[model samples]
Target: MSSPQFSFATTAEEVATAFSNEIKGKNVLITGTSLNGIGSETARVIAKHANLVVVTGYNEARLKATEDALKKENSSANIRRLVLDLSSLAAVRKAAAEVNSYSEPIHVLIHNAAAAIGPLNLTVDNLDSQLATAHIGPFLFTKLISPKLLAAGTSGYVPRVVWVSSGAHAFATGIDFDALRKPNKEGYQAMVAYAQAKSANVLMGIEISKRSKGRVNGYSLHPGVIYTNMNQKPESIAEMQAIGILDADGKPSTEKFEWKSIPQGAATTVAAAFDPSLNATPGAYLDDSTLANDKVGAHCLDAANAKKLWEVTEEIVGEEWVF
Candidate 1:
């Protein structure tokens, strides 16, 4: 399939304009939409086009701030906010049920929420925090809301689920299911755990596309190495400074690398969610606002691994999502 006309330089707002006519009455949902992150920016642009836009995050203040900001930016924008902590299964279930209660079928679901480079820990559900937040929680939420997506498809809307993965998935050799199932502090590393979770995100996209059998499309993408709050921890800043990625004042060192602007970073996500060219090619991995030619990783593309991960995820979430 041919890629969309968009390129790496395309901004989220431009992508929205390109699809505004078609998306005017669509229902879109996005997670992890804090004030200035990619999720929020994507939602901001989509809100201008979509009939209803649902923004979600774990922080109440940030969620409200985003909601207010979106309304402030476009007074006529139809927007809603919901609390969704991807680390908590209970919270995910409640949020999914609440979203399901809405009369409109969801036309697009963007899994833009993720936990990266956080301390190794376990959630109340006994799963690794990074894995739970980045994969398991979203997995359960997607399964719960899939019926809505299918319904939207039946009604002539192209329903899509976009997973915001990272190129970091290439850093991990493969997913250590045993370690993820029972984390051990002796060998835990934040980035490695994050990479594993990201690989799982890609695998979930592949599996969902296969399971949905074209009723709903699934996509995963590397949103580029944009500077975001998730990577602005004191430790992270110090590490980046050491590597010359950031300076002492916590700004990008342009000579070393050019970090993507927020809109540029969100362009691919916006494209993945609404690009008509991708409707025929579900489960595609995208980067720089285009379909990635290189493999994300061997394990990420393994059908057997994707199926196993899906089964284990269902067991961990304590729910069976029969498609």
Candidate 2:
């Protein structure tokens, strides 16, 4: 079948409705989910047709709220709540163990939460806050959950891992494994740190495909700039102002970017996970709900860097991913 044409104006519900067959009977999981972000909206759409939808976050109340909201939207929707804080390796390990206990394959996994536009703060793992939340934590979680993803793939479902990246990835041109090992607080710049983390997110799409040999497809996307909770922080706004994204009044400047609504922001992510057309290009990146590899930085697409990231990540996480 020819790929359905979608654009920036499309909504997650539209794509979910269009690809309801792909979603039917599928069990999907999304991280960083809450009512205030794209993850919940992505989960909402998937829950409309998916057999089971697992929503995760660090906050138990927020996960419960997300569960209530999804159920309100579709009473028959099957929703499971998991507490996952991507910035914490300890939390990642605990969550990974919980997911394994269920013993069900996750047909689609979306790494949608991120810690962007923040001051440098190191986690217990000694990784920078932005890098740990946006990349390393998700990287480790994906590795730990590979058994579930592989089970789905072996069962004839084309399992996928989707990383929601950002256009701000252009702020960095390369990976800094040393910085991840030893965060340079004195020289730390939020944009650069966040950019490198997002860049790692893009590379996951590239590397996971090669590692899994197409059995578990990987995809990355830019969920168009939106005013989510990530943007509501004063520090986040200050960082955006430094880059001319927001005005002195903290409003999105129309000249520099066209911000998307929450639903529109999640459209590309939904398409990345459920669009059958994406199966043809396992590790491709998407923008505005369309395949747009040219939109990402060349550094993020480097095959050598992708491989290096996979290796360094295992060491940083202190675990081996044999698959």
Which one wins on TM-score?
Answer: 2
Q: What does each candidate score in C-alpha RMSD?
A: 2.0, 1.2
lDDT of 2 by residue, 67-88 (tens): 9988987999999999999989
What tens digits encode model 1's per-residue C-alpha lDDT throughout 1-323?
Answer: 45447776889998888877767888999999986689999999999989999999989999999999999999999999989999999999999999889899999999998765655777887778889888989998998888788778854555889999988899988888887677888877777887898898788778888987777788999988788886686646765676576787988888777689899999989888887777767899988777883767998878889988888888777888777
| TM-scores for every predicted model | 0.94, 0.97
> Native-vs-model 1 lDDT?
0.85
- What local lDDT does model 2 show for residue 262? 96
| Model 2: how far residue 270 lies from native, Å | 0.4
